[model samples]
Target: MLELEGIETGYGETRVVHGLDLTVREGTVHALLGRNGVGKSTTLKSVIGQLPVTVGTVRLAGQQISGRLPHDIARLGVAYVPETRDIFGALTVRENLELAGRLAGPGADWTVDRIVAFFPNLAERLNNGGHELSGGEQQMLAVGRALMASPRILMLDEPTEGLAPIIIQQIFGKLKELKASGLTILLVEQNLNFALGLADDISLMGRGQIVWRGDAAALKADDQAHARWLGV
Candidate 1:
């Protein structure tokens, strides 16, 4: 569902991602794993149109999406939940979801009611301000808001960062449900077990390029690649 070929992008004069090539198949969870400073996030930024692709191509569903505006790319059915977990601090939980649904427009399968059902904890805190929620609730709100867009492909960067193990399990459970419902996912994760447990396919990145690509079982069994590139 998503493809990047020879993707090269960086901040300012220093190039971080070098000739990165990767693909995420439809209805599958593709995990991009690497140690810090290897440009995993940069590759995601390039695909989502936040970073300029100086070289190579990005395609979604067989159409060229490279160089498109971020919102334009989003309208093409890509939903990105950055590591920042950016949500309006002052808005009520219900209000945030409302705004997201409005932005997503009509005819989307993800309605406020549907999302509230998917996230029942969010339903209980409908009137609470975003700032009043706990870390886990905030993360759930972020994912819930993204789903309000009814996106075909969900791209997450460090979705489990800084959360407790219980919270991580909850988030992963939601993700598993989403995957079961046939949504494609591209995840950049640091937790080896989390990625290995959930990912259908895995790609190890090193020095800004994909060094190995295989199924999750293969990645689990490849001790050399894990030690060399992932430092696991």
Candidate 2:
């Protein structure tokens, strides 16, 4: 459902992702795994139009999305949840979600009620400010807010970052539910087991390019691939 072809991106003069090609199919969870500084996040930024694709094009479904403005890309059914989980701290949880809900086009199926149902913990916290929630709660709010936009593909960068084990499991469980419901996801995650459990396809990135691509079972058995590409 999403494709990046020969994309090169960087910060100013410093190059990060170089000629990286990857694709996420419809209704599947594709995990992009890599150690720090491998440009996993950069790839997502490029897709979301937060960073320019210095070389190749990004396509959603079939149309080329390269060089479009961020908001335009978002309106075309791409929702990004950054590693920082950038929820509006001053806004109540309801307000935060409603802000994104306003961006939904006609026939949108995601509403505050649906989001609350999807995230049961959020139901009671709607009146609470973003800052009032714990780290896990904030992350839930971030994902829920993104869903409010009624996106076709949801990209999450390090959804497990900075959370306790229990919370991480909760997040993973919710992601599995989303996957079962056929919401396409492109995930960049550091947690090895978490990624393996959820992704239908796995791509291991090294130095700004995809070095290995395989399914979870193949990766799980290939200890050499794990050690060489993943440092496992």
Candidate 3:
């Protein structure tokens, strides 16, 4: 479980996020959705300690982690897959997975073989450099690398960005499977349909604040909520 309250953060005093509050329960997918520049990514950065919170607190399973180092927060069972997919271009797929596992220490759930099994395409490209993979393959590698950390909670920013529709479906399928296996996901997504299909709850952000929050299905059915907050 993760909880954030009244979080204020910015890039060097030019505040981008203002008083944002969010909650993600254990074993559930929580979607944070908003238009561009509304601070979805900034909120995640604050939560993961990539950026310092100017106010309020971030707690994971009741342990405060707001200002901790990103590595420390990661060691506390939080894994982040940024929008850029952050893979090492020169590293082989196997090497990348191994590095992630080593960084996570022992007791990681996703072994290299297991990650390959989950992503058979990755197994096929084991010897290939990250730069040689297609966007979909790169995205899979990103997810696999994060899984190597064996996190209880995974935070993904735009996991489906720039992928083919079929690949997007595949990624969502994998996300569904992870959810069924008891992984708590905090997703910052632009694809509302994909997110709504998987999320247990939805929190819609506007102007760097949560203007709407509710059950995913209910919000999906509420035209007024969509019009007012999502503008779609």
TM-score of each: 0.96, 0.98, 0.97
**Native-to-model Cα distance after best TM-score fit, residue 173 in candidate 2, in Å:** 1.2
Tens digit of per-residue lDDT, candidate 1, span 125-147? 99999999998899899999889
In model 3, the Cα lDDT at residue 156 comes to: 96
What is the RMSD of candidate 2? Answer: 0.9
TM-score of 1: 0.96
Per-residue lDDT tens digits for candidate 2, residues 36-75, read 8899998999898999998999999999998999999999
Cα lDDT of model 3 by residue, 1-37, tens digit: 9999999998996899989899999999999998888
Local distance difference test, per candidate?
0.89, 0.94, 0.92
- Model 3: number of backbone collisions: 0
Worst 10 residues of 1 by lDDT: 97-106
User: In model 2, which regions exceed 4 Å deviation?
Assistant: none
31 Cα displacement, candidate 3 (Å)? 0.4
